[model samples]
Target: MSTPASTSANQQQTHTPVGLIAFAWTLVGVPLAYGLYNTVKAASALFGG
Candidate 1:
């Protein structure tokens, strides 16, 4: 049901840029890592680890 041009456009839209993917992961990962590190530190202190 799709024409060639429209198909190519769809394909382009579906493909995400590598930089954008990395940036998104970094945006989420930094905060997640920070929270995890603090949690582990707190747990260690609580348990005398």
Candidate 2:
């Protein structure tokens, strides 16, 4: 007796927890931060400072 809308609603993707999302972003962020840090370091060397 379920309508299409009701069936689709039941099949919706589950929500990821806030903590897990943050952790996933951190997993991406760490390497990015390191790359930026190294880039800045290399750029600073060109200025001889």
Candidate 2 wrong stretches, greater than 4 Å? 1-13
TM-score for each of the candidates: 0.71, 0.64
Give each model's whole-structure lDDT.
0.89, 0.90
lDDT of 2: 0.90
In model 1, which residue pairs have backbone atoms overlapping below 3 Å?
none
TM-score (C-alpha, index-matched) for candidate 1? 0.71
On residues 1-49, what C-alpha lDDT tens digit does candidate 2 reach at each position? 7567666657778788999999999999999999999999999998877
Q: What is the TM-score of candidate 2?
A: 0.64
Q: Output the number of the TM-score-best candidate.
A: 1
Q: Please provide, for model 1 over 1-49, each residue's C-alpha lDDT reduced to its tens digit, 9 standing for 90 to 100.
A: 7567666556644678999999999999999999999999999999985
